[model samples]
Target: MENSKMLSPEQLYEKKIHVIGRITILMGIGLSLLVPILLWIYYGVFPPMDNLLKGVFTVSSFMIPLSIAEILSFYPILGSGGIYMAYTTGNIANLKLPSAAIGMEVADVKPSTKEGEIISTIAMSGSVIMCELILVVGVFLLGPISVKLNSPMLKPAFQHILPALFGSIGAYYILKDWKLSVIPMIIGILFSAFNVPTSVAVPICVLCSIYAAKFLYKRGRISL
Candidate 1:
C-alpha cells in the first residue's frame, strides 16, 4: 500500500497500459490461431503437422521481418498507447500512422512527446472506429460498389492501386532525402534487373535500407 501510494500517476498509467496491451495482444493472437484449428477439427481433415509448420515458416519469413522493421520504425513516434491501439487495429503504415500523423499535425504536437502520444492514440482509435463503420457500410453496398469497381475502364487502376498509392506516398520521402534514398532506389533497380521475386526483394531491401541508414547516422551523415 505504501509503495502503491508512492507511485506517480504516470507510472501507474504505464503499468496499466503494459498489462492491458499484453493481454489484448495475447488474446488476439490466440483467437487467430484458434479459428484455423477449429476449422480443421470441424472438417476432420487436418493436414500433416509438418505442412502446418512449413506454411507458417513460409509466411513468417517475410511477414515477421517486415513487421519487426515497421515496429522499430514507428514505435518511437507512436508511444505506448498509440502502439497498442495501432497494432490491434492493423493497417499501421497506410491508415493508422497517417491518421495519427495528420492529427498531430493539426493539433500542433510533435511526435515522441507526451502530448503527441496522447493525441496520436486518440486519433488512431477514432480512425479504427471510423474504418469499422465504413466497413459495415461497405458490406451493405457491396453489390453496387463491386459492379462499379469491376468496370473495364477502372480495372487498370484497381490492378495498379498498390503501386499508385505507395508511389505517391514514397515520392515525398524519396525527395525529402534524395541522397540517402539513392542507395535503396539503386537496390530496388538492381533487384528488378535480376527479376527478383517481390517477396524476397522487398524484405531484403527493407533490411538493407535500415542498415544503410544506421551506417550513415553512425558516420554523422544524417540526423535522426
Candidate 2:
C-alpha cells in the first residue's frame, strides 16, 4: 500500500482535485434529486398528510443542511464513503462516531499498483462491513425500544439503515465487476420478487453469484 503522507506535492494535489471533483458532482446530483425524493418519502411515510407543500418544505429544510454537512465533513472524519452511510443512518445506537476518526484507517495506505488497489479495496470492504454489522445490531435492538417508547419517527427512519448499508456494498461490487457481480444481484432480485424468504434467498443468490464469478474467472471467461 502506498503511504498517503509520502506522496509528492503534485500527487497530493492531484488526489485532492479528484476528491473535490467527485464531491462536487455528488453534491450537485444530491441537491437536484433532493426535493422530489423527499416528497416521495413524505407521502410514503404519511399518506394522510394532505398538506403536501408544507411537508415538502419542512423536510427539505432539514435534509439540505444535513446533506451538505455530511458531504463536507463525514469523509474527512469517517474516511471515504463512511460519512455518507453513517449520516444516512443517523448514527448507530451504541457505537458513537469517533472524535478523531479518519474514516477507514486503511485508506491512508497508498495503492501504487493494481494489487495494492485490490488489497486496499478489500481492507475498506472489511472496515465498512464491521461498521455496518454494528449498526444492524444497533437498529435491531433500537426498533423494539423505539416502539416501546412510542417514537414513531425513529422507527421509520431507522428502517432505512439496513437497505442503505447493503446498497453501498452492492454498488461497490457492481461498479467493480458489473458483468460478474450483477448475475447474483439479478438472481437475488428475481427470487425476492417471487416472495422467497429473505433468509433463504439472499444467501443463496449471493453465494451463487460469487461461485459463478469464480468459475468464470478460472475458465478465463472474464478478467478483472
Candidate 3:
C-alpha cells in the first residue's frame, strides 16, 4: 500500500492532482444534473423524454462544440492545474481565462511552462474566490446597483463591457508580441470583415498565427 517508496514528491502530487481533478469535475457534473432530476421527482412532473432530449440537444448543440473548441484554445495558456481549477469553478472564458493570462504576463512567465502553470492556477483560484465573494456581496447590493446599471448614461458602458475587455486585453497581448500579432491580426480582420462567425474566426486565426510564427521563426525572420 506504500507506493510512496517508488515516487518522488512531485510525481506523487501530479498523480494526485490528476485523480482529484477528474473526480471533482465528475462530481460537479453529477450534482448539477442530479438536482434537476431530484426536483422533477419531488414535483412528480417529469417532462416528456422527447422534450427532455430536445432540450439536451439544444443546449449541447452549442455547448459541446464550444466547450471542445475552447479547451483546445485555452489549454496552452491555462495548463493542467489551471484547467482543473478554472473548469471546476466555471467561467473559463470570461473570468478565469483573462485572470490567468494577465497574471502570467504580469509575472513575466511565459505560458506552457511550469512557472506559467502555477501562476495560472494561482490567478484563477484568486479570481474564483473574488467572484464568489462578489456574488455574496452583490446579492445585498443588487438593488442599488441595478438602479445605476439601468441608468441611461451607463447603458453604453454595460453594452461594451466585453468589447472593451477583449479589446484591451487583446491589444496588450498583440503589443507585447507584435511580430506574432501581425498574421493573426490580419486573419482576424479579414475573416471578420467577410462575416465569418466569431467562433470560426478565433480558432482559424489562432492556428494560422501559430503556424505563421513558427514558419517565421524557422526562417530566421524572427528571434524567439
Candidate number of the best lDDT: 3
What is the lDDT of every predicted structure here? 0.83, 0.56, 0.83
Whose lDDT is higher: candidate 2's or candidate 3's? 3
TM-score on alpha carbons, each prediction = 0.80, 0.34, 0.82
Candidate 3 per-residue lDDT over residues 93-193, each given as its tens digit: 77898899889989999888878988898999899989999999999999877987899998888898898878887887777678888888788788978
lDDT, residue 191, candidate 1? 94
Across residues 119-215, which tens digit of lDDT does each residue of candidate 2 receive? 4334444555777898799988986676565677667867887888767655654675677876776787788789875545645664586589889
In candidate 1, which residue pairs get closer than 3 Å at backbone N, Cα or C atoms, i.e. clash? none
lDDT of 1 by residue, 1-224 (tens): 78768889888777788899988988888988897789888988687989989998999877876777677778767889888888886888778887887788789998888889888888998999999999999899997789888889998888887888878767756765776787789999999999986667777777788789888989988875
lDDT of 2 at 94: 22
| TM-score of candidate 1 versus the correct structure, residues matched by position | 0.80
RMSD of each: 3.2, 19.1, 2.7
lDDT, residue 40, model 3: 86
Ranking by TM-score: 3, 1, 2
TM-score of 3: 0.82
Window of ten residues with lowest summed lDDT in model 1: 170-179
